[model samples]
Target chain A: MFFRLTFSSIRHYAFRFSLAVLGLAISVASLVYFLSFGEGARRLIRRSVEDFNLQLLVLPPAQSLTVQPLLPRSLADSIRSLGVGKVYSILRLPYTAGFPPRAMGVVFGRDFSSSLRFISRYEVVRGRDLRDSTVREAVVGEALAKALGWDVGDTLTVGTGRYIVVGVVKAGSPMVDNAVIVPLNLLMEDMGTDRLLAVAVAPPPGKTEEVLSLLKREFPGYTIQTSEELVKLAKSFVALGDAIRFGLSSIALFVTAVLLFAIMAITVQERRWEFAVLRALGATRWFIFRLILAQALTVSFVGWLFGASLGWGLAEVTSRVMVEKFGLDLVEVSPSILILALLVSLGVGLVGSLFPALSAVRMDVREGLGR
Target chain B: MSRLVAESLRKTYGRKAKTVAVDGFSYTFEPGRSYAIVGPSGSGKTTLLYLLSGIEVPDSGKVLYGDTDLTAMGEDARSRFRARYFSFVFQQFHLIPYLNAYENVSVGLYLKTGKTDHGRAVSLLRSLGIEDPNRKPYEYSGGEQQRIAIARALITEPRVIFADEPTGNLDSKNSEMIFRILTGLASEGRTVIIATHDLALAEMCDVVLRLRDGKLVGS
Candidate 1:
């Protein structure tokens, strides 16, 4: 009887209840859509850090956080003389300063004389690897090639210099698969800069800590970071990004809760006589309270169903747009996101219906029946 | 069947204006009998019914049902007591609008037992001359709606039945039929207390009490 009464009341106000559901659905959709991007970016950064395969990175103290031309090219040789590990200099210049860094493709220049661990990991899917480091030749990642329609013989322009594409590479990881690579010395001369982004050091066998201690002592002014430190930094960045996105989505959730609350409050007012009748018929105050709560939860549960689908659909569209317009795929709708959306929507339902349920419980039965 | 006894019952309505709805009313209602409380407007017929049924707390009173004092119990306790032993029919019929005639009757059974007896509800509705028990309250006429309300009260098989103007909205024909049905329940060993304006229907009960100015005037 309790279940029948609750559902019957909801059906009685079907149109009003549907409006509340739609409002809640939109808020939950925004929440799911926003969090997807943060999750995607976090996953990408973690993969890139893991695949780098080097023991340490030597960066200029102030510019250690970003991958850009801030360290002198001589730092690679200075690190190499120690013989603790092989060294390589990498130069990365942004094509254009833009809102999203990935949209502005990087002019990635690295030493071809020694096999760069980062570049060696991916397979050369077409043409050949960068041969003759002095020649004006370049290699492009699979994503960058596909985005710009670059082929093996295509000529590409990067920072006032032109180079023929010698190879197309595939790295599965988005970070490496979205850059245009060239020889470090030629790129430096073409861009008219004697600086490099950073020097990567591969420690011999089990001498990682020994090499790190030696480098940190030798160049106290620089930042020597291990892969573990880089991963920790990435995790912190992901956490901050998640916090900001969730904060922005909270506004929509608040509005949704208020909308539901208003609708439920009005419904309670209209149904006062019915509640009084039920009480007179021997229903306890707790039963009346639970009936209102059940109605609210039903609305939210339906809203969550529609909202999760809409949010995931929106996330997919955003991912496609980022890939086509910005050359970055950074939106992931995971199972955890759906679960979180459900919990959040249910929370809204509970908050929205609390006052109305209390009012129903505290109603004066005699007055409500108009006796 | 349990005997109902009221001692010096008094109830007030407002704080400033202070309308005394029921005042100094005392009576002993025997079991297995029908009693009618007939009064004009604002004469406390409804308030006295409410006080006796534990729906309202009197300013000063002792209403005992078989040695259990209804006035001494808490609100929830009174509600439980009512659910376990009493049933009510109102002036407006008060059938749950969303429920069908059969569901309305079954709701009473559910309230009493925590589960419904569908067969008993259908039987009661049929006995009360509700031809289409599947119809909602709006589909029924005034008399049919009242019949559905009575069926709801009967489904619980309550020991005491309270009817406050049960046929107020019905025609003369339906009013007599309702009065006969209520009187028949008294013969079957259930206490029936009715508050009504129609003296003709009031005289049909075993005892008729008249009231004026919130106090009993004649019997």
Candidate 2:
């Protein structure tokens, strides 16, 4: 019965089936559009946290923290005592070239092993890693290297004084790969700040929160955080992100749903007598219902397939466009997002088809046939 | 047991001073026989078929298909009963215009597994004297469309087939052709009940039921 009903529906080729699937696909795409950035950020943060090997990141409350470079400082040693694999202070300061200043640069300083955690993604494309801090030494990002034009053994004025070129590294992330690395004390001397910005700690696997909870309990004045917390903070940013994406995609999906409803309503209306005839021919109300359901499912599935792939592609294009136009990082959209979108579209199609399918059932086949 | 039985069946449209369409009707239609109800407009033949076929519930009394009271069933049960027990043809030919002849046949076979062979559909249509196999109802002549409708009814292999004024839309020449096909079904032992006023159809049937003012008066 499902077989013949399918054939009958296909024979009708009402186009709504394809349209529905397409609508669903687009909805899926809308979902992708809405969630892709968050997905990418989520991925990148996990990578960074893994690279940092820091079990903890302690800082001030997010609202009070204002330096775009360094998060707020915390008591570094208390966190280190709490079964941490290791602990280190991280510092970032704004540096300019001349005695007066020629160009601006962000100078990040830490213990070489510790700094490597935050910048773990980088690979030395040329030169070497940062050496001991008594002598001014620096490791530049590949792009920063290109900009400064100093190779191995060349001296470049880093903050107030000259530093020897050490190793250049490439972290995969564009954000990190573009940064300059220097030894911890020089960064403090360069910034003239005694307070370290934040402390990063590494602990045993899966004990991240257990450690942060302890640090938060031990040191109440300084805001204590971790990579997981940072990821959580970044993830919280997605509430706003999701709201914006949902707002945009809902408009498109709402239109798709309404359009699907209207088209199906019209098609059902047009087929009144056909339904009537089916009823007259001994089709029970259930049979009539199945017919409409079959039609709706057929249309919605086709629409979803088209809409998901097309919408995903559209999302990809839109992300690319944003990248070129504004240099904004739109995250990688997931297949699940597309699948989710498709599911939403199907839901919309199912909801939209309800009234018309009932209408088909209610029509009098005898009167319909009389006409 | 007869294929169809109506025992004192009655149907009235309104509540106060209601309009009665079928009143106090009792009839028994047997298998392997053809019966036609003859009546003028508003004489209740079509309504009576509607009641017996379980498309409409009778206001009073029972329509029994082998002891199952159709009027006792709910919408879903009646519909299921209808799907398995009978097929219908109608005056307007009521063929799905969007579907071709073969596709039209498939509609009648809904939800029935192995009812997929279009070979039987094509053969049946051809047997009914339809020459063009691929045309939809609108493209076919009224006679051909009616033939397709008949073929649709047969495709389900229902126990009984009901048709409301099966040839009412056709010319007498085409009408005679439809009669032959219907009579042939009866000869094959499938009960056929056709609601009509065409005496030519009535004279050929195994029984003729005469309806007047919503009552079965003469037979």
Candidate 3:
């Protein structure tokens, strides 16, 4: 009977109830979308960093951005002797490539035979991998290939020498995906430099800190960084994204709460006589309070269910577009996020109904009936 | 027999002018009898009914129900007392707008006993000539609505039924029908008190008390 009365009252004011539900649904959806975007971006960055297999990069100390720093090619052998995993020397230089020669692109010179064994994240999506052929060949990242409109058998000028595109690759990381990769010996001869810019060493599992500490001690004048440090540095650059997401979500929740509060207050006022009738029929104040709260829970629960499903669908589509257009894996709807959204909606319901329920219970029966 | 006794009951309303609605009024009502409190407008007939029914406390007096002082009890205790020992029928009928005839009649039973007897509610509605138990109060005529209110009062089987102008909105035929029902309750050994302006209805009761200017003029 209690539930019937409550539901009947809700049906009596269906328009207002729907308005409240819609408002709550939109708020919850926004919260889920924003939080999922933040979580997805973080996961993408972490996965990209982890794909390097705890790799460490050794750079020259006090290297200036305007001047390319060079390290001895023997540094790779020295690092390999420290009981670490495979070590590869890389020489990176800015070079204009493509038919029209696009600007702001780097050419990474690597040992073609050992590069695949050392870099865990590299994967060829098109054409063939680099081989020890007499012809000069290059593997461009997916982004760089798209930008230059280059495919297999296509040739591009790199520092007065042309190399055929051997493979289109996906490096997972945006920075790496934008670069072109070629054989180290060919680039070194073309640049007239035997020195390298950096040495990338994949440390054995559970030996990252040991390798980093050993390399720092072995070469006091060099700068070394493990994958963990690089990942932390990358995350620090996107801290603002997280803060903005949190702020927007908080504002959405606040607006939901306010809208719910206003709707509940109006409902209570409209039903003042009904509450008085219940009181006159020997209903306790607590019973009236519970009835009001029950109405709020019903509205909130339905709204949350609808909003969560809609948000999940939207997030999936958004993630797909991001991956295709921006090459970013941003928007994953996890179970934890769904549960948090549910809890937040229920909390909003509870808080929104509090004042209205109190007012209903405190009404003077005679006055309400008289009105 | 159950009896209601009021001694020097005084009730006043408003703070600035302080009009006395009931002043130094006293009465003793016994079971198995029908009583009518008759008065003109603003003469405190409804106020006296409210005092005796424990709907409102007296300003400066006591109302005793078989030796239990109703005014001394807390609000919840007074409510429980009303649910157990008394039922009320107002002039407005006061039927819940959303509830049908049967649900409205069974509502008091649920409140008092924490359980509803659907069979009893159906029988009462049938006896009162209400065929459709699903029709809400708004769908019923004024007389039919009053009959539903009476059924609600009777469903509790209280020792006393306090009715404040129960037939005020009814036609002549309906008024006579309502008087017959109140007289029938009195014959069944339940006390029935009604406040009204109809002299004919008051005459049908076993006793009549007239009030003028918040004081008992005659009995």
What DockQ, on C-alphas, does every prediction get? 0.69, 0.56, 0.40
Instruction: Report the lDDT tens digits of candidate 3 across residue range B10-105.
Output: 999999999999999998999999999999999998888778877778999999999799999876777778888888888888888877888888
Q: Chain B TM-score of all predictions, in order?
A: 0.98, 0.94, 0.97
Q: lDDT, candidate 3, residue A114? A: 53
**Model 2 chain A poorest ten-residue lDDT run:** A63-72
Q: Write the per-residue lDDT of candidate 2 for residues A192-278, one digit (tens) a residue.
A: 666776776766677767777777777677666655566777777766777788788888778877877787788788777777777
The residue-by-residue lDDT of candidate 3 on A207-288, one tens digit each, is 8788888888998888787767667866765667767875787787788889889999998998887777666666767878
Instruction: Give the TM-scores of the predictions, in the order they appear.
Output: 0.91, 0.85, 0.78
Model 3: CA > 4 A from native? A55-243, A249-253, B1-7, B52-54, B63-69, B80-85, B113-119, B186-189
True contacts kept of 3: 0.24
Estimate every model's Cα lDDT from 0 to 1. 0.86, 0.72, 0.81
Tell me the tens digit of each residue's lDDT in model 1 across A70-126. 887778888888886778787777664345543556677868755556555778999
lDDT of 1 by residue, B134-219 (tens): 98899999988988998999888888999999989899999999999998999889999999999999999999999898999889
Candidate 3, DockQ score (0 to 1): 0.40
Alpha-carbon lDDT of model 1:
0.86
